[model samples]
Target: MSRKENAASLVQDYAEVFICPVCGDTVEVVELKSVVCPKRHTFDFAKQGYINISTRSMKVNYDKELFAARENIIMKHKLYDPLHTRLLEVIKVEAANNPRSLLLDAGAGEGSHLAKILDQMKTVTGIGIDISKEGIRLAASKSEKAMWLVGDLANIPVKDQSLHTIINILSPANYQEFKRVLIENGLMIKVVPGANYLIELRDTILEEQKRFFTNEETISLFKQHYSDVQIEELTYTKELHQEELRDLIKMSPLSWNAEQESINEVRNREHFGITIDLAILIGKNR
Candidate 1:
């Protein structure tokens, strides 16, 4: 099918999950290309295979170049393969009984992680939502058999009690919105940075010492809102070539504040070993 046709098909397939961003009314597919609510609000599907569900314009710091850099670092370098594997293991168990499970990747920038996970699972549908228009455009163009939307995390455009599994990887969380949208017994998988994450990059550019990250406060907050909370820590060091190193610096926000000279210095290195330290937190709605 063509890209426009695929996008329309996705809208027809998962129309029920969408709600009018302006009025909060349930939306239905109309003519396979637009979604309309009872209140007469309509959203059109873009030719590139995504929908814009935002009611107003909002600007963020991310851009096409950053997302492109992220895609290269993720797909070409396979930097997060281990984390992806672990996520699939947990998702397989959660979705064992229900083959047609629904998964949402909140803050799904560029949609690489969601697409990779969906490629391994059968009879499962995924939704990738992000606030950045550029990120959503890249995701819609590259990831097939999924729905993409430009929406906010604080006020998700999905209906209440609609999602079976929600994945928040290296993104901020809105627990109240998450709990409201999740089905009963739905699983939420969140990944946060650990103390040693990207130590090499930190050491390369920064002059002053910075405190290490700890998840004690975050874990405590999660426990207050969810049941059966579990946490797993993963840490490893990987060697990166010069090009991969350049993409890595471009993909991260840490380099945004650094001087051009500093960025060039890091990019010019022949090779370097960087640490990947992360914590995966899993929880179920209380």
Candidate 2:
């Protein structure tokens, strides 16, 4: 069997804690005990330490190359690190001691952000759902500590009111599904680029389309669904080498529409630096 076929539960150790995704009831885990709701819904926690929380299929064209670009950019500390660090700090401070706090990463690509958050909190489990199977496969390969599924963000697979924190990292949001799965005071965190974000890279990729999102506009959307909306813009500059710079260009959606030859030219150019205008929004589900 290939490594893909050999994927299994990360461990057999589990606490006496479980939640019914349908009714939002708390359940206990006994040895060899599979999850069974009062309504007779049963979900067995795989030995691989994850769950299949997606109810429907979501099709997409993302392949290994896309997931690699995402992972490479993240590892280089150029684009995602600042936002990723903020997420870890927020979860540790706000939702640390809940008897049960399920972290659902809506557009989790390769499961890096969710995995980092899990490491920061002592007792937390996460479900990473992506539209691409290749993304989940890479995540599962990295650590059996988290669960990965091939699903879409618009339609989540878990029970209602079952989450403590939900992270949308440069991904799409399904606010209605989020409201259903969150407690009254549960938090939703989002990271989007500021208008001037990655201008250097955009110079080559954005052909006067102006695709940057407005922080206030996003805040308004969140306000439409969630209350106590708070928005902060983090601006920082990073130094980069040629290889790291090349990876950043390869991984972004901006590169997708660019001519392949032009992309190659940009990738081959020498060392460069880019300023990142990252906006973070955190709020409650009203």
Which runs in model 1 stand beyond 4 Å of their true positions?
A: none
lDDT of candidate 1 at residue 19, scale 0 to 100: 80
Off by over 4 Å in 2: 1-58, 76-78, 211-216
Q: Write the per-residue lDDT of candidate 2 for residues 93-196, one digit (tens) a residue.
A: 66666855667788888877776667666766676777766677677666544656556565565556657888897777888888987777888898887877
Clashes of each: 0, 7
Superposition error at 3 for model 1 (Å): 1.6
TM-score of every candidate relative to the true structure: 0.96, 0.80
lDDT of each: 0.86, 0.68
